[model samples]
Target: MTDETDQKDQAVEKEAEEKFPIGGCAGAHAEFRKGNFGTFVMRAQPVPNIVPPPPIAAKPLPPNDEIYAVCAKKEIGDRRGKSFPLMRRWDDGKLRPWDIFIARFGKQYFAYENACPHSGQRLDWEKNNFYEPNYMKVLMCGKHGAQFDVETGVCISGPCEGQRLTSILCFVDDDGDVCLTGINIDLDADVEPVKVVDPNSDEVLENNGFKLQSTKREFFK
Candidate 1:
C-alpha cells in the first residue's frame, strides 16, 4: 500500500515515546499518536516554598504632643539598685492607674510618684518593691516606714517627714527610649504639653495612653 501505511505511521510514533516519558513522575499519563504528538502536559505535583512576612516598620509615633516611650534604654541597667514602673496615660478621657517610680541614680534617672506623700499609700511595699529589703538604699515605704531620697523624693524618715516624691521629667530618647518630658497635668504656660527635648538631657526638656494592651506590670502577683 502507500509504503505500508507510511511504515505503520512511524511505528506508532515510536511507541508513544517509549511509553509516556513526557516529564512524567507525578501521576504521569501522557498520550499521543492520533494527530502525531505535539500537545503538552508535564506535571510534578509538590509545590512548597512560599515566603512572605516582614513589614510593620513605620514607628515614629512617640509624640502626639509630648514624650511617651517607656522602655528600652538598655532596660534601665546601670545598676544602683535598679527599679521600674513608669506606665503613664494622664486623662485623655479617664482611666488613671498612674505610677512613675523609675529610680537608678548613678547615671541619673529619678522619676518617683508611686505615691506616698505620707499615707496616701502605694509606695510599693511589695509589688515591684520600693526598696527596704535590708537596705537597698532607702526609698523604702513598703506601706509605711517611709524613707524616700533615692536622689530626692525627700520624705527622709517616715510619716511624710518633709514631703516630696512627685518629680517626673524624663529623658533618654534618640531611640534609647524612656521619654516622658511634659504634661502630666496642671496646665498653664500657653496650654502646657509640648516637649521633645533631649539635648543629651541637660537642657532639662522643661518638665514632664493606653487603650487595650494589657501588660499589668509584667505579672508575678
Candidate 2:
C-alpha cells in the first residue's frame, strides 16, 4: 500500500478506538456499535428493586384493661364492619396507636384487632373493606390474601393459616350496644380516624362505611 493510504487507514482506526473504547463508549457501561447510527449504545441494565414501607404499629395499652367506650349494636350483615382507632398508654406512659375492628358472622358478634397476624399489617384492603364478595363471610387480608374466620379471627387460608388474630373482649351493654372491653386499651381521649389513600390514584378515598360524625362506625367484614 502507498504510505499516505496506510497513514489514513491508521488514523481512522485510532479514531474508532478513541470514540468507542474497548468495553464501552461511555465509561463502564458495556456498549455496542449500532451499524446504522454509527454510534455506541449502552447495554440493558436491571432496575433496582424497591421495598414497600411497613405497616404502622399499634399503640401500647396500659397494664389493666380499661373500658374505653361503647359502640352501638348494629346488625353485622354482608360486608359489614367497623374500625375504632384508639391511643393506648403503655408502661412507659407514652401514647401509642392501635385500632380495633368489630365484625359479625352469622348471629354472633365479635371484635378483633385490625392487624393481620401473618404480615403484621392491617386487614382491610381498602378503608375497612375486608369482604370477599361472598356476603362478607370471610375476612381477607388486603396485602397477601390471607383469609380469616370472621367470628374467631383464626386464619383459615393464606400464608398465615393456623394462626389466630389478636382478639379484643367486647360486651353487650344493657341498651343492646357493644362495649369496648379489651387488653390494655383505654379510649377515653380524643381519637382521629386515619385517612386512607388509594395507592393507584393517590387521592384520598372514602373509608368504606367508616363515618367521622356518627358514633356508629360501619364497614365490611
Candidate 3:
C-alpha cells in the first residue's frame, strides 16, 4: 500500500510539471514562495519606437544691389493691396526705414512709398488698412479723404491734386516673387525709426525736379 501511494504522488508531480512548464504560472508561483513576488506578476508587451519628420527650411535673403523679393506674387489678388516695411541705405551711409505698399490693377502691379503726397503721414490710418471701406477703385489716404489713381500714382481728388506718389520699379520674377529692381538698396541693413518725409521734401524735391527738367529737355531735343 505504501509503494502504491508513492507511485501515485510521483505521477501527480509529473503531470503538474508538464501542464505548467518551467518559467510558467506554476514555476512563477514557486519563485514567489522563494520571496520573489515580481516573478509571479504579468508583464506588458514591448512597444516599438516612433520617430518624427524633419522641418522645412526657409529661403535665404538676397545680397545688396540685387533683386530683393518684396513678397510672393500670389499674396496680392486683383484690385487688392498689401504693405511692407523696408530698410534702405542712403548715399550718406545712413540707413532709413521705408513703408511701401503694392497694389494690383488687373494683371499689372504698382508699388509706391506709403507716404501721402499732401502730408508726410502714411496712407493708412490703421495698421495695413490702405483702402476705402467699400470703394477699392482708388487708393485712399486715411488721414484726409484723398484718392489717387491705381495705374498712375497721380492724386485725382485731394489736397495734393496733380502730385504723384514716389514710385519704385518692381516686377514679378521667374520664381513668382514680386521683386524690386533697378534700385540701390541694402536688404541686410539695420534701419532706425525716423520720420518718413514726402517726395516734395527739400533735397528729394530738388533731385526729382532736376530729373523732370532733364526729361523735358531730352524730349524737346
Q: Which candidate leads in lDDT?
A: 3
* lDDT winner between candidates 1 and 3: 3
Error of 2 at 77 (Å): 4.3
Worst ten-residue run, lDDT, model 1?
Answer: 203-212
lDDT of 3 by residue, 125-216 (tens): 44455665465788877666677898788988878889988888888988989988756566676544434444343321121113111111
Off by over 4 Å in 2: 1-65, 75-79, 192-221
The residue-by-residue lDDT of candidate 2 on 1-221, one tens digit each, is: 69999998788666656766564545323333333344443444567798889976644643465564456676445457667786667766666666878776654667888888986877766565666544567887766777888778899988889998888887677787777765775566666554443334532222233322212223322
**How does candidate 2 score on lDDT?**
0.64
TM-score of each predicted structure versus truth: 0.26, 0.58, 0.55
Q: Between prediction 1 and prediction 2, which has the larger lDDT? A: 2
State in Å the error of residue 99, model 1.
Answer: 3.3
lDDT by residue for model 1 (70-129), tens: 566666654233334333333343223344557665566666666777657556543455
* Backbone clash count for every predicted candidate, in the order shown: 4, 6, 0
Ranking by TM-score: 2, 3, 1
Task: Quote the positional error of residue 194 for candidate 2 in Å.
Answer: 3.3
Model 3 clash pairs are none
Superpose all Cα atoms of candidate 3 onto the true structure and report the RMSD in Å to 1 decimal.
20.1
For candidate 3, report its TM-score. Answer: 0.55
Q: Residue 63 of model 2: what lDDT?
A: 48
Off by over 4 Å in 3: 1-65, 191-221
